[model samples]
Target: MSEPEIRLQAWETHIEEFGTQQYGLSFDTLIKAVGKGPRAAHKLARRLKKSGRAHVVRIDYGSPGPWRNSKNFDEPGAAPHGPLWMFADRQIAWGYLEFDPGEWHPKASTAAHLTAVTELRLALTGLDTDPQVWTSERLLRRRLKTESGLAGIHIHDAWFQDFADPDKVWAVEVELSRKFGDGRLTRSLSAALEAAERNDLCGVLYFVRGDGLRRAVEGAATRLAHQRNLDRLPNLEIHDLDATLARKGVR
Candidate 1:
């Protein structure tokens, strides 16, 4: 792993270490450990979640954090410009919010959890094979880019290390997301492409949920994934939300 990637990995491991002792955390508490502000906190949180070592909860505690006289937890950023908390590992760890009760619901709990499992498992490499499972009503969270008061949710899943098709990693992101005008989905695809051009491990796979993006991104991703596999990584692939999930089970 590169220096930055190494550091990123270490930080996630740290969260897992601490998270094991606790159960969940508010953004404020995490700020102390990962640093303050949405970007920094988000960066760390995304890595933890993507790395499969943690689970993140977007808590709505009114406009500003500190949630003076708080009420209840809800969807992450459900009300905009709200504090989101990172909960680690199967509701067994904490990211920072150690005091507040995490937002809880039943409607999509099963699918949501399966989604988490599907996502985190992506980080696995080598012979970590377990039969793919089935899930429904799940969504692959999108990574946030550009600064905004209303930030898009950031999600991290897995990155594969490859050299034969350095740009192959880019295909993963390309395979995800059926549509997002103005390269919203393309940016990630580009990042992977750049990695492959450098001959780095292009094992990373991207999974985008929703339609339109499917034809657009997948059309390009499939061809690239096929070509890259021919060049190297015969077993690797760049798949959209459904295919990737189907490979695992539900989709």
Candidate 2:
């Protein structure tokens, strides 16, 4: 196989070879490192997609700068559950919950989701595992401006892209909490499920605060999952904060 083909194979093998499905391999890096022609590289990508050996997802490398909010959203502890500005800002910092402006006080359980993702990453870090967690933050923002324009708009916390290969990519949106934050977990999961199905995402994962809310959110996520006829895109998974973190060894 050619060098580009080798690179593609390496990337697709990342999950089993590394830990995260996220492949930070630069396109430029490949051009210089692998003495493959442009046509060869493109062909390799096409083959990867056709073979289901890998997939692609938009990535957002958020710019670095302090967050700005007209209503002092940047103010500390503004959100009742967490910081409302987490999503408002262009960057994805450390936070469990991300505020959503679409619905009345909507929030996504990023804490549980990220905790699970990080756990999986940590567990497979040393040996042979590689499942990448990619961000389409930048692309999403640019899209906001291109589509939504200069005017302020509600931001969707973070768009997590799951790409196993060029043909097996998925987008995951997390919904957490039933009361106070966000409109309704059921509705939130529904929207995510809808979007994921439209795109190539495997499915949505709903992480509730506790098992008490599990049935409600899971039912919602599962129903949405089935309605879209997507059994894989948005796999409904509920996570309890305390227990999930403890199990993952995050203190």
Candidate 3:
């Protein structure tokens, strides 16, 4: 068994590595990474908090609607009902709003970002079984020469593949409300293809916020597929975010 300090250091290091990239860390995810029992983990978390090493953020989802604030919290152990443990220093700097316990909700919250954290939690769960997970934030920066100029691309929200093996990894992009034009779609498809061809990824996964967004993304995927050839399009998997949130029992 790892010593308490060692375990705590693992938590800190994990936060420094990944928590700084995405939105923040979840309580459950933090515990899993620490490899400690829940109660022990909670105690460690409290210690981290007391020591100013971490913070447990409370996320409250507003009613569902078109506005970014309308997003729902559906992941298991997600807040208003539970707490999200994040590194104190990494929270606001990583795009998550500052933790204000008195406030009902954070100043900013997005379905796509939250979904990324949830997906990351799912990835952490599978660590014991085998595959190593890497998010877009963790990916090595690669300079890809586009027709216009050299575009530096790195950091995907979450990657589904083993780090040690050469197996094709899946790059995921969570889209809640952002609109993409044809040109952007073409560039995205081209980038994915380039990444795949370079043996950096096996495919791409787009987690859209709703049915409407799904239609839009699918259209782009289809268009890109038609232009790039049938085989490349199959590599893109567009999924509905709500269903995933519900499946995870976030609500």
lDDT of candidates 1 onward, in order: 0.42, 0.39, 0.52
Query: 190-247 in candidate 2: lDDT tens per residue?
Result: 5665555555456554444567676676666566666678763335445654465466
- Expressed as tens digits, the lDDT of each residue in 1-251 for candidate 1 is 63344245655555444433223445554554443455676677766665665565554423344443222334444443444556656443323323223443222223233333334333222112211121111111111222222334323233333335433432233232143566554555545555444434434455555567555665555555565564433433544565554575332
Q: Which is the winner by TM-score between candidate 1 and candidate 3?
A: 3
Which candidate has the highest lDDT of all?
3
Residue 123, model 1: lDDT of 27
**Candidate 1 TM-score to native:** 0.33
- For candidate 3, the lDDT comes to 0.52
Query: Which sequence of candidate numbers ranks them by TM-score, best first?
Result: 3, 2, 1
Candidate 3: segments with Cα more than 4 A from true spot: 1-23, 26-45, 55-85, 88-115, 123-131, 134-136, 139-151, 162-166, 180-182, 229-232, 248-251
lDDT of 3 at 33: 48
lDDT (tens digit, per residue) of candidate 3 on 1-251: 94355334654554434544343455555565455556765666666665555555544455333322212223454334334445555443433322222222222355336545555445433323222455434222221223225456534555666455646577766776746664775576566656654545777767777788788777777777778667447667787766775675442
Stronger candidate by TM-score (2 vs 3) = 3
Best by TM-score: 3
Q: Which pairs clash in the backbone of model 3?
A: 74-250, 74-251, 75-250, 76-250, 136-155, 136-156, 137-155
TM-score of 2: 0.38
TM-score of each: 0.33, 0.38, 0.55
